[model samples]
Target chain A: MTLTGEFFAFMSLALVAVIGGVLLLNLTKVIHMVVALVFTFVSIAGIYVLLSAEFVAVVQVMIYSGAITIIMLFGIMLTRHHGEEAEPKGGGLRKLLLFLGVLGFGAAVYLGIYDLNFEAVPNTLHENNTEQIGISLYSQYIIPFELTSVILLVALVGAIVLARKDDEKEGDKE
Target chain B: MSSVPVSAFLALALILFCIGLYGALTKRNTVIVLISIELMLNAVNINLVTFSKYGVNPSITGQVFALFAIAVAAAEAAVGLAILIALYRNRRTVNIDEMNQLKN
Candidate 1:
């Protein structure tokens, strides 16, 4: 296909994804927000597929849509009060200012990058990219990977400790 | 159909990321904040995978990293919700503003 046509297609998909994300953000009901977020993740996976990362796109759906969203839903179910009204908090002006500040910062960064005519080194996609990645991970990046595992282990322990009830302490005393 | 440009993918990821950030900052519910964080993480994954596909010879690294990220996110969700559950058990409130034990 022509570059112009491709750009138009991408633009449309991007627009849809962006609109979905915004809807997720603006919705007051938490459950609706979660549903919108699922849409956002799926659309992003579509973008990944369009970029030619079919493997990554599938993993995106498998993990984010399958696991993380379900986790968030469980959290919501555990936390939300049954049929209670959401409390109203007033800070509209401050929120608006913060939002505008973020927008300005983003615009400035984009413009600055655009002005700099940076050239990227072109690389072609290979069939054995996944194998190469595995080789590198097991060889050069193994230490960091191990460290990440250890960090996750520590987080798990900490979480369990934090969640432990003090009833045990009272039981020991008794 | 023509191939999609990398820029379009990046732009969508950026917008999703920003909205996630906004939700994280503005939302009071802990669950919502966690979901927003997941959104941001997914945005990063999209960028990594897109670059891997179009800009690199070995495209597998991005997907591998994305997998690692998914694992981390799952761990995070489990631990975060566990903590939230504990907190709810003790205080019966999930509002960040109300959980100020260290505000000396």
Candidate 2:
């Protein structure tokens, strides 16, 4: 409500994030779009810090902005893009309709959250944020944490299998 | 953003999610579609962390949930990109509509 440093920080970060998303949508070059999204990802990290989730903010920086963006760029490089994605002529009508639909959905959600105020409870999440996450993750969330590792392993194996060149198929091609 | 209302954070998430949804639905490129999905997930993370700080029962749980979400999202992106590469190799195209075949 009142002018505060936190308010300015949030405003600037959110503005950059929104601008990055807009650029991602509007950019013609596929690589440029992904690059634009780095701004979004980093600003989201700033937002995370503003929300008093320092550990999550660091993770957002490391994982989302760092790792995921690199993987996306790799994905883009591996695939052959024709500069811009070709939208067929006359699909503008459908795009416009989709835009309107998305706008309507956003408006509906906005109305629900516009007056949604929660009384701020004092939480110890900020003090030793990383240690809090570690304790909780190793204690109450141990099972899910173990499950995540398993999931990552499965995804790793599956990706290799899917992306590996088919020797027999190549032989068949010859 | 201690002074900023919870609604503002929620609104930011909502806007990002909408942008992501629209991009995913309309983009022809498979990579961009996947990126859009990641953006949607990021928006969800914002909501989770927001509620963690400002909810009726604020605690560390919401942030823990967000960590799990990030892990899952990373795995999903890896698999999705792998699938995209494989599809590109077989089909020689990256457009989503062109990938509408079980067997050629």
Candidate 3:
């Protein structure tokens, strides 16, 4: 409850994340939202570090902040959006209803979970976290790990198939 | 090392989730809505890691789940954006409200 260095670090990171998320929601420009999203993802990586999940933290930064942000930028560019009004605004009543829906869901979850007290386990990873994660992933969870790769392959193929323009139209015209 | 309480992270995830939910629900732009969905997934990652650290059985399983979630999220974003680009090529706009061709 009292102030400590951990508390300060967590507070600052959490504040940055919340602010970034808020800005992402309210920002009028797509590029601004992507930047805010990067800020939020980086803050989440910091939180993962705080939780002692170093491997997850690294993956978060690499995948979420680095790969995902760049891909989104590419998407925006390829889609050919023009000028500053790229982000369209929602209607007032719809916005109010959406806000209320989110508020209600958050309140319900908080009310359900607030009463339960959680005891913090001291140092979940006794050895190297990356080693432990690798061992577990390769040994016990190998099926899912391989399945994930397959999923990625499928996604790659799907994206290429969907995004590539068909050449049949030119052939048919000839 | 004075440990931070589990409730703090939980609260943070809650706020992030709600913000994401609001954006995903109300945003007119398809790309922003996709970004909002990523936000919600990140909130779930925070919760999973928090529980893995603080839970009674504390193990690497939750972290592993988070890893899978992240991979899946990346794939989802890639595919979603690809689809969005395809739609844009045909429709020339990214507004979700105007894409009412399926309403017939």
TM-scores of chain A, one for each prediction:
0.78, 0.95, 0.90
Which CAPRI category fits model 1?
acceptable
Model 3, A37-76: lDDT tens digits are 8999999999999888999999999999999999988887
Clashes of 3: 0
- Report, for every candidate in turn, its global Cα lDDT versus the true structure: 0.71, 0.92, 0.87
- Which one is best on DockQ? 2
Displacement of residue B9 (Cα, Å) in model 3 is 0.5
Q: Candidate 2 lDDT, tens digit per residue, B16-47? A: 99989999998889999999999999999999
By DockQ, is 2 or 3 better? 2
What ranking of all candidate models by DockQ puts the best one first?
Answer: 2, 3, 1
* Residue-level error in angstroms, candidate 3, position A116: 3.1
Residue-level lDDT of model 2, residues A62-82, one tens digit each, is 998899999999988988888
Model 3, residue A4: displacement in angstroms? 1.6
RMSD of each predicted structure: 3.4, 1.5, 1.9
Q: Candidate 3 lDDT, tens digit per residue, B10-98?
A: 99999999998888887777888898999999999999998888877789999999999999999999999988977887788888887
DockQ for each of the predicted structures, in order? 0.47, 0.81, 0.69
State what share of the real interface contacts each candidate retains.
0.48, 0.86, 0.68
C-alpha RMSD over true interface residues, model 1: 3.6
By TM-score rank, best first, the candidates go 2, 3, 1
